[model samples]
Target: MQPMALWKRVLILLVCLWGIAAAMPNLFYAKVEAHNDAVAAIEAAGGTATAEQEAARAEWPDFLPSALVNLGLDLRGGAHLLAEVQVEDVYKSRLDALWPEVRDAMRDLRDQVGAVRRAPSPDGILRVTISNPDGMTAALEAVRALGSSVVTLTGVGQSTLEVTAEGNDIVVQLSEAEKQATDDRTIQQSLEIIRRRVDEVGTREPTIQRQGEDRVLIQVPGIGSASELKALIGTTAKLTFNAVVSRTNDAGADPGPRNLILPSMNEDGVYYIVEATPVVSGEELVDAQPAFDQNNRPAVNFRFDTTGARKFGDYTAANIGAPFAIVLDNEVISAPVIQSHIPGGSGIITGSFSVEESTQLAVLLRAGALPAEMRFLEERTIGPELGADSIDAGRIAALVAMGAVGLFMIASYGLYGTFAVIALMVNMALIFGIMSAIGGTLTLPGIGGIVLTIGMAVDANVLVFERIREELRSQKNPFRAVEIGYERAMSAIVDANVTTMISAATLFILGAGPVRGFAVTLGIGVVTSVFTALLVTRAIIEIWFRISRPKSIVV
Candidate 1:
């Protein structure tokens, strides 16, 4: 057979070499990971590295490729949690926001209605009592004007607020369609917030997605435990600045109608009664970082967006000499007097905190608050020892599979089988290299895929070899048999790999977590196996034949 073109052969060799180099980092994963972390820390800290970090950085050279395939939860043994979000909390928040608007709308008819007072109601419903029942019609009209169109597919023309009156009470609640849209938005936001919280700490690829209507599944690899994960991500971090009405020592003190009694976060006996409505919420925060206060105490520095900045500036200006509370998760952290109009949307949060606590608080603030609280329904922590055992088992399985396949190929087809084995090894390297390059995660099922691919990698070569045997039986010459064998087998090889590729793609699109991990490796293996069989193995045989020309050959 004629040799391949010079450029083509050169390209083939380069691809194999690239794959090997890209995958080499995995052989020393711990060292390379430490090196990467050290380099990242130095860069983040303005090119200053600790002595330990410098030592770690020396483990891997900067010029070498260091990308690695992330290990999945099951393979790496980490935290797994299934949590249910309290979606009803969003309904309460919506009602709280409507209070000011509704109150203003009702105030227009104050002569007829007399007085407007918010009365305690169920979580989603808003009840306001009017002094005169005769103004019910005007009250309803006023609230209805506040209704805006819901911007969801199903609620195209529906109003967001539903207003109705019963006796002297004017009741307001979210419309049914609006509630549905709110629930979906809340869940999606929760999912994104959790993912951000997980990714903020630089943990490897985490699986965090919505499951049922109110549930979310979280699997974070390389974490300490499920409880640790819950602590890291489950905190709502609901930061807000509120108008403090008064201070009290009673735990169950009544804060009148429009105020809430919250205990102090640091002081044991102190509590503050703050307005139910927050002047500026955490959602308006644009950025947060760990910092040190003027006293060199650990603190969190926060910057707000334009709208929040304006609101904060206005509130501080109007409420000078009055105390406002910084509340986080319903606990008053500080109630400092507004000394002056603090502008520019930037401030510092100082409290009794360790360096680690300040850093973690900053991360949470930057990631944003969960729209609602999460209650963990299930939690599991896989230990490192268990993960190491799993890795060993998977490694043994792959090696046994590869050795068995190699033996069978050699026994079945003799000399040509050795070339197939070499190609198969290259195909395996290419799979790892591509996965590492793409930052794919390897799960337990992904190990199965690799083993399965090791067994199937030689199938294309087997077909070509069998076809050559057929050609020899038909009185063809050796070189002609080799050429025709490849030509005839090409259609079958393409068809087989194409079908497998479709299946892998379907799984990748429809599946989640471990299933997607499996699909990723399988899909990559299919392409690499095809390349090594059609080109790498064939090239080896062609070069061999060129060097030692034989008249007759046995298959």
Candidate 2:
């Protein structure tokens, strides 16, 4: 066989070195992970680091590659939660918000419809009554004008609202198509908000994805507990600036027809009755940051977008000396009298809040409100101890498999078996290197795939060696026998690998979570083994033959 080209030999050497270097950080996983976290924290702190953070950062070499293969929830152990989004709540909120527009439309036609007032209605319907029955036609036409075209793929041609006259009352509700579209939008918004909240905490490899029509599955790796995860995401954080109606200490006070009662967040046994419609809602808030108020107390400073700024400016300008409540999730956080026309759209919220609470509230507000409420269906916390045990078991299994394979190969072919063993080690290193480069997560099944790869890595060598034995029996030269052996075994090796690659691809596409992790390692191992087992072993044998120049050899 012709000697391997110098370029090819150098390329092989470079690839092997790269794999080993990439895999080296994983051996000191905890130290490197701490270093990464410390670096991230320092960067977030604007280059200011605590003594502990500086110590952690110094533990690992700065010049070494730090990218590591992520460990999945099953291996890292964190929190899992399945939540069902209350899409109907958004339907009610959207419908309730329509009352202002409807009232405004009919008010412009007061000469025809007379005085208009909102009537008591259910969650998803808005009913308005007028004094004059003869104005029913005018009212219907005015309300219908408020309806807009539904902007969705399936509801493009449909109107967002259905307006009808029931006696002297003008009733309105979302159309069927609009309801579907709203449900989709609400679920999507909730998913994004939850993802933002989780990412804000710097947890790694979180799986925040929609499950079905209204369910979301959340798995956050490296979080403390399920309760902690739920606390972080479960808070609706719905903020509104409502007109203050009345205040009371009674637990069961009756609010007026268009007013609602909410308990005070700062005061015990206190309540406030606020108007249903908000002057501005949290949806228009563009930014919120934790800060100190005039009293040096923890507060959240907020800035509004252009639309919110105009509304806020007009309301504060008109309602000077009148108390307007800042409500969060139906609770009155504060009721402050408007001192002046708070013009710049920037305001501060002061309450009895600790620094930690204020910071978390700022994060939640910045992430934006969840369009609808979420009821958690399930909550589970996997302990890191269990993950440690799994990782240890996987490590031991991989080491045992490698050792057993190496011993078996060495006993079988003597010198060439040693070559196979060396190539097998390189194969494992290359698998890890590929995973690290791609930021792949490793699970228990992935470890199993790695162990299985140990066996498969030597299969090609076994086939070629058997073929070489056959050629030797027929009295061929050593070099010629080795050449024919690899050539004859190439077809079987290719067929086996082709089928395996197909299986790995299928699993990766169809499977979720840990199954996909298994597929990733198996697929990567298949490729690396081909390089190390068939090609690298051949290269090693070639160098051995060139050095010895043996004319006769024992198989």
Candidate 3:
């Protein structure tokens, strides 16, 4: 309205554009070189890389930031996994950490409750068969006395009280708040551990988010097989060091065969036993790389931190002839004997490893260690065929919608409609540039939302242009009319966009996956459209009025 503020508006717009570009590099332009490198690596692996990857490799320029807006598996035709961690493993970890107290508590509960009954279910959830439910309350008090923490006490059958761990695997009595705290912690820790594992596998852009309590949603765009992914993440990566039972110690031992340390077991009874306590755990290892053994076989070479190296050297020197097992997720990969003491704190793990298997083992060993053992729950695969169809349909739908909206605006508003069309183009450019800068995935649903946003963006300009016509009818000059129209229509435009933005925000917070993606494009469109219409379009109109300086304002 104030002479279109050309220089000021352009400067502000540039600043906004630059900021978006800095924050997100995915939407506006694709980075070519890194994309090409990814293609080359995959091709070198004898895998079928995508056409886009080939194009990127051939044409990608240098100097783009490493970050890219990665498409979701639904759009890119990749792998999806839903993993549920073993709550029992979580409980066991806690119990093992607090063994002295937990063992004592369970023993005290058994003795105090007396007459313990087995749960009807096959899962072996034990219950106390009390003479009176009220009498069992005293025994519960004794269990609570083992620790001051709250305990959960549930009545199963008439005289049975079901006592179990409140979180993951460890059952303990806790208040509502404590239960919530435990749930929060497990989810948080699991997310971190999963992130570390997934990163090790070298996915382009993987997403690992917590779903409802106790479940995690993992999406890897370029990954093909769900089973391989499940194998990669289902491991809890729990490593323990235990003293080995010697042959002499097994004979009439006071501590019953010197404390038989059982290895971790899979559902099918597959288990591994570490013959000796690990002088240094996987946590101490800083890096792992695939290498070749003396026989040119695939092997994983690992290096430990200073402390780990020192401990390893000391332990190997002390136990020169004994065998130490290389265990993973409770299964032994290999158990090589300490032929001679090596003090470097670096060693190679040689096994029956293929090239891929060697790489995977190196990844796992390098990903630090998992807090607890995990298990696979569910998985799904979306083929490239479906993804291609979605892209084509989405593109056709967007073109049709934009063409229809453009025709309607020009038909209704005549000459003024032409200006509204120009504003629409600017609005679109800004949206795309912003999206590219942010690197958000452009899904089919996201495209639908953007089309809807374009219509809403045009609505604001239409309202202002119509208001200007009304002012001209009231015998005002074109300049005066444009100013008044902008002033009069500003409130309505603000109210409309604000309400829509609030709704979009609400959807974003509550929705999951695709729904959230839809909300994201919708919300971004609203803010950018508002800026283009209220400032950019207004400036263009006012500047035209100043130059023309027409006597009679055409309606």
Candidate topping TM-score? 1
* Alpha carbon lDDT of each predicted model: 0.92, 0.91, 0.66
Q: What would you estimate as the lDDT of candidate 3?
A: 0.66
- Model 3 CA deviation exceeding 4 Å by range: 12-56, 63-69, 96-184, 199-213, 240-322, 334-358, 366-377, 546-549, 553-555
**What TM-score does model 3 achieve against the real structure?**
0.70
Span of 10 residues, lowest total lDDT, candidate 1: 134-143
Q: In terms of lDDT, which candidate is strongest?
A: 1
1-555, model 2: which lDDT tens digit per residue? Answer: 767889999999999999999998999999999999999989978999999999999989989988788987878899999999999898798878888888889878899988899888899998999999898998898888888899988888899889898988888999999998888888889989999999887775687888889999999887899999999999999999999988999878889777899999999999999998899999999999999998899999999999999999999999999999999989999999999999988999999999999999999999999998899999999999899999999999999999999999889888989999999988988998889989888988999889988999899889988999999999999989999998999889888988999999999998877788889999998899888967899899999998999998765
- What lDDT is reached at residue 36 by model 3? 47
Cα lDDT for residue 485, candidate 2: 92
Residue-wise C-alpha lDDT for candidate 3, range 218-310, written one tens digit per residue: 877767778767777776565433334432213233434114334322223333333433456787888889999999999989888899889
Order the numbered candidates by lDDT, best leading. Answer: 1, 2, 3
Model 1, 1-555: lDDT tens per residue? 667899989999999999999999999999999999899999989999999999999999999999998988887889999999998999999898989988888777899888999887999999999998987888888889999999898999999998888888988999999989999999999999999998999997899888988999999999999889999999999999999999989998889877899999999999999999999999999999999999999999999999999999999999899998999999987888999999999999988889999999999999999999999999999998888888899999999999999999999999998999999989988999999999899998999999988977899999999999999999999999999999999899999999999999999999999999999999999999899989999899888899889898887
Off by over 4 Å in 2: 1-8, 38-59, 108-112, 134-138, 148-157, 245-251, 292-297, 313-324, 335-344, 411-414, 459-506, 552-555
Model 2 per-residue lDDT at 147: 82
